[model samples]
Target: MPIQHINPPGLLQFDAMSQVVVASGGRTVYIAGQSASDVNFEVVGGNDYYAQSVQALRNLRTAVEAAGGSVENIVSSTVYLKNLTPEIAGRFLEALAIACEGKSFPPHAFSLIGVASLAGADLLVEITAVAVIDAAVAA
Candidate 1:
């Protein structure tokens, strides 16, 4: 299956995202919101935004890869945090940018929201993503 990325002309230079993603005949995987919690559901970071964010992304990668997709196959992502600020948001984007490193990762659609709390008191960040895996590649 071939994935098409849409980008319109005359957009600002800072726009780093494709307008949309069109996948043809692919398997869809919806991962549950992954938090810093381990398999036992114990929070990995205690009131730490950066650490929790990293762990959450790592968990998201594992879940996606287990379903036969890699981080580059992620089409969308939603991030939730207990405390959201300009600085915190910058940190979040910076972390993802570092991981991508000029690779093509489906659509760049994503969100970061501030919440009162997460699943646990120690947890600070949770993330969820949807990936499209090529079925033909599997067989």
Candidate 2:
């Protein structure tokens, strides 16, 4: 794994994310957007941002693991939040911490965007990620 997480001197650092991630010499894995839906495509959380965020992050972890990588291998991610607010962001951070089993969330570059809606009315968050794993480690 040749991934370097950097938070430049002048840039603000965050516990949940890295300012930049540089990865080389690995198999790139592009994970599709994962939401709070279960295997049956039923929304797991209803009108609860924290619950939805937890489910979404869990789904993302599953996707990465399926690609023979873990959350630590993720280099970048894009988060889409419907009706974003400070409270919602706070809930998301809490959810992320829980999803990581109380460990620090992976230091992956992240972009959060606020949207008006998602694929479904109940969906509150969706996450898409990109990860890199050693060629031999790929499934």
Candidate 3:
């Protein structure tokens, strides 16, 4: 399964994300929405969106790896923010960049939402992702 990332000219040069991700060659994994909760389901990084986003990304990584995929395989994701702000958005992206092993990763596409709340008051972020698992890699 060969996944091709397409970045057409005149458009934004995609970073961690691509404008179009062609993963038609393998299995697509739809990971459930994840928040900044620990193994005990207790929310972490209370009141800090950056910390919460980092935790959420970690959860996403765990799920992806468990499915025989890596975070790089994620093609798209949607982020939910309890209190959206410019600083918060920047912090989230900063945390994400760090999570991507200090490299640029935007994925194929992403949608960020401003929400009143999440599953709990302590939670500040939740992320749902879609990824492709190469058959050979999964094997």
Evaluated with lDDT, which candidate comes out highest?
A: 2
lDDT of 3 by residue, 1-139 (tens): 7666777898787455577666767789999999889989998887888888888998998999999998877878899988788887888887777765566554566777888888887888999999888833221
Deviation from native of the Cα of residue 110 in model 1, angstroms:
0.8
Point out the worst 10-residue segment of candidate 3 by lDDT: 130-139
Write model 1 residue lDDT over 42-116, tens digit each, in one string: 877666676676678778888988998877677777889777888888666655654443432334557788998
TM-score for candidate 2: 0.92
lDDT of candidate 2 at residue 107, scale 0 to 100: 67
Clashing pairs in 2: none
Q: Using lDDT as the measure, name the better of candidate 2 and candidate 3.
A: 2
After superposing candidate 1 on the true structure, give the runs of residues whose Cα lies further than 4 Å from its correct spot: 9-19, 99-107, 135-139
How do the residues 22-126 of candidate 2 rate in per-residue lDDT, one tens digit apiece?
888888999999999999889998889888988999899899989988888888999899999888888888887778765756768988888999998889999
Please give the TM-score that candidate 3 achieves against the real structure: 0.85
lDDT of each: 0.71, 0.85, 0.80
Residue 60, model 1, lDDT: 86
What residue pairs are clashing in model 1? none
